[model samples]
Target: MGKLLIQGGIPLEGRVPISGAKNSTLPVMAACFLAQGETILENIPEITDVDVVMEICREMGGEGEWLERGVIRLHVPDTISCKTSYTLAKKLRASNLLLGALLGRFGWAEVALPGGDNIGTRPMDLHIKGLSVLGAELKIEHGYIRGGVAGGKRLKGGKIYLDFPSVGATENIMMAAAMAQGQTIIENCAKEPEIVDLANFLNAMGARIRGAGTDVIRVDGVSELRGTRYTVIPDRIEAGTYMIAAAATHGRVIVENVIPTHLHAITSKLREIGVRVEEGDDQIFVDGAGLFRPVDVKTLPYPGFPTDMQSPLMALLSTVKGISMIVENVYENRLRVVDELQRMGAQIKIEGRTAVIDGVARLSSAQVKASDLRAGAALIIAGLMADGETEVSCLHHVLRGYAHLEEKLTGLGARVRRIS
Candidate 1:
């Protein structure tokens, strides 16, 4: 096991380039199964989650290799296996996406139940419902989600209305519907930028898809899909984390290679908390040398404040002047990180799905363990704002999402080191 030893009190400054979206890369790599030729992907993040997804893709008979730094060459075969490794599939949540891609391609898929950060109940019911509506037969047997189209035939497109705007479900339905027999319309679907990126990728390969940035989406099925090269969007969640970190430590940071519009939700929240944010064509500048005000945050789907950022934002809010509250409408147990933050002298309380925080004048360093990916990042932010030293353990979770996190923070003048 490894841990991050951090000495607090340094203001982070300089440019930290945002990596490609891990959420976007996984589904796009899974979508490669729908095509039958070479697909080149650029700006892929060097994260453990990407490694897991690529391994799963290889297990399904697709050949993938790194062409250069942040570039990958994937050759999807005409015929691929429908069964995925249970051991590998359980390692990450994106493995569940393989069911839709494999089912769309081979008309059958036997994938294991997925596992990732234990933040909340992320079931595959919506995925199965959408796929089933698109003419798939899904069933959970043993530990795998088994079944596909009846008689091994092509999936027929049908309208699917999601009860909630689940991002994974929306992407699964979109991928399966892309190769269906007819037109498919999805109502109340997730409108995240990653969803639009996936739609753009699929459309680039001849699938007719529209209304991606809205709650409604339309997909006209194509008989065959050819591979195409694509680039992924930058990680907005990572950018938000850095922005919040700068505020917590009263630093100036330029988060580069990001789409400013994609971060409107985060930027607005930071501004509300008295942080100065400037937007350029593709970069966001965050200056945090002023007093912060306590604000209420509610995590909503897409266009709203993201649930992934709630933990880190809460860490920053802990140093504000007054009381702040964060309503986690997306995940149930996300506030579980409050215990670790409390170890660092943060005054936080959980009332149901809401976290009531009383901002402290300062925080003292403590030894803490990262419970999940985003929570791990929240600890690092807290460590940077605290006095003395803080050691954050269980770095595997943080590595699953952020790429070269220590190096990035170090470049920004934060005193952090990885120790075994």
Candidate 2:
């Protein structure tokens, strides 16, 4: 594991180009199996999670190579292995997405139960339920999800109503429904931008998908999908993380190559906290030198405050001059970072799903450990604004999502370096 040594008290300034969305790229990469021939994907983020997904793809007899920076050429085989090893599938939660693509193409899939961040209890019941509704027999036996259509049958699409707007379930079902026998109607689906991106990628490859950015998503099954060149969307969570880092340090940063509409929830919150956010065609300029006001935040489904951003936003709130309340409705254990923040002079209290933060004048440096991906990001934001040097350990968590994190922070004028 690597560590990040950061000297605080520098206002980040300059343009930081956002990387491709990890959430979007993972599913799109898995969707490559739905089609044969070479499928080119641009704007692929160089992150551990993406690499892991690609490794899984290669293990299944598919070929993948990086044509250039942030570009990948993937060649899907006519037939791929139906089983994914536990060692590979346990690397990330996105591995669950492969089940849909594999089942859609091969009528069978045996994947291990996924392992990712320890944020909360992320159950696979929804994923199993959705696929079962689409005519697949699924069973969890000895930490593996073994699923297949009996008698070499293809999945037949049907109506699936999610108990919760689970993004993983929505993406998994959509990928399976893309090549199913008939139309699939998914109600109360997640409306995240990544979901829309996956839908667009599948559509480019000849899948009839509609109502992506809404609660109701309709997927008209096709016989088979063809290969097509597609580009992933910018990482909104990464862009928001940088925006919050800039805001915490009272800096000015222009986050480029992002869709402004996708960040309305984040930008509006920043403005509410007295930060200046100016939106452009594909960029957002954040100026955070003004006095910040404490605001209440509630994490909800898409078009609302994202749960992934709760930790970093809370770090920003730690430096404000008043009390703030954050309600994390998405994940139960997301408040795990509050203890680490408190070690750095933050006044915080967690009561069930709610967190009460009493903002202080400034925070002093401390040796902190990151427990999860977003928690690592929150610690980085805190380190950037601390009074002295801060050493952040467990950097592997951060590298799982953010691409070129230290380099990007350096480009923005922050003093940050990786220590092996």
Candidate 3:
């Protein structure tokens, strides 16, 4: 593992370009397997998760090569192994996505149970239920999800209603239904920008899908999908993290290469907290010199405050004038960062799903460990605003999502470096 040493009290000022959405890239890469020929994906983030996905793809007989710094070309074969080893599948949670693509293409898949950040109980019940509804027989055997169509028949599309708007389940069902026999309708689907990107990528590859950024999505089963070039959307979560970092340090930063409309919830919440946000065509300029105020935030589905941004925003709220209440409705253990932040002198209380934070004037540096990806990001923001040096361990979690995090922070005038 690596650690980051950050000297605090620097007002970050510069332009920070956001990378491609990691959430979008993973599902899109998995969807590429459903198509024949070559698929060129642009603006792919250089993260550890993506590398692991590429490795999994290669293991399944797909050839993936980096065309450029942020571009990848994947060539899918007509036939591929439907089984993924436990060692590869346990690398990241997105490994579950392969089940959908493999089941769609070959009508059978044997994938090991996925593993990811120890945030909470992220079950695969929705994924299994959705695929089972589409005429695929699914069962768990020896910690592997074994699924296939009975009688060697093709999947027949059907209606699927998710108990919750699970992003992984939505993406998995959509990909599996793309090659099914008939029409598939998904209700209460995830409407995040990443879902829309995946839908667009599938459409570009000749899959008939509609209502992507809405509550209901319809997919018309096609005979086969052909490869095409597609560009991914900007990482809104990463952009929101940088914006929160700027505000926490009383800095000015321009986060570029983003979809301004996709970040309405984050921008509006920051504005309500007394941060000046200037929106442009594809960028947002955040000025944090104004007076900061406490604001209540609730993490919900898209179009609401994202659960992914909850931690970083909490770090900013720690420096505000009064108390701020955060309700994390998506993940149960997202408040794991609260303990790390409290070590730096921030007063926070956790009661079930809500966290009541009483802002302090300033925080003192302390050594902390990141328990998850977003928690690691929150610690970075806290370190940038602290009095002295702060050391953050568990760098692998941060690297799994953010691309060149230390370099980006250093470019924005924050004193950050990685130590092995």
Q: How many residue pairs clash in all the candidates, one count each?
A: 0, 0, 0
Clashing pairs in 1: none
User: What stretches of model 2 exceed 4 Å from their correct place?
Assistant: none
Relative to the true structure, candidate 3 reaches a TM of 0.99
Worst ten in a row by lDDT for model 2: 143-152
**In candidate 1, what are the lDDT values of residues 1-420, reduced to their tens digit?**
689999998999999999999999999998988998889999999898888877877887888888887988787797778888999988789999888888888899999999989999999999999999989998999999999797789999898999999999999999999999999999999999999999999999889999998989999999988999899999999999999999889999999999999999999999999999999999999999987899999999989999999999999999898999999999898998999999999999899999999999999999999999999999999999999999999999999999989889999999999998
Candidate 3: give its CA RMSD in angstroms. 0.8
RMSD of each: 0.8, 0.8, 0.8
TM-score of each: 0.99, 0.99, 0.99
The local lDDT score (0 to 100) that residue 359 gets in candidate 1 is 94
Better candidate by lDDT, 1 or 2: 2
lDDT of 3 by residue, 1-420 (tens): 999999999999999999999989999999998999999999999999988888888988889888888999998798888888799889788999988888888899999999888888899999999999988899999989997986777888999999999999999999999999999999999999999999999999999999999999999999999999999999999999999999889999999999999999999999999999999999999999999889999999998999999999999999897989999999999999999999999999999999999999999999999999999999999999999999999989999999989889999998988999
User: Candidate 3 overall Cα lDDT vs. reference?
Assistant: 0.93
Candidate 2 has an lDDT of 0.93
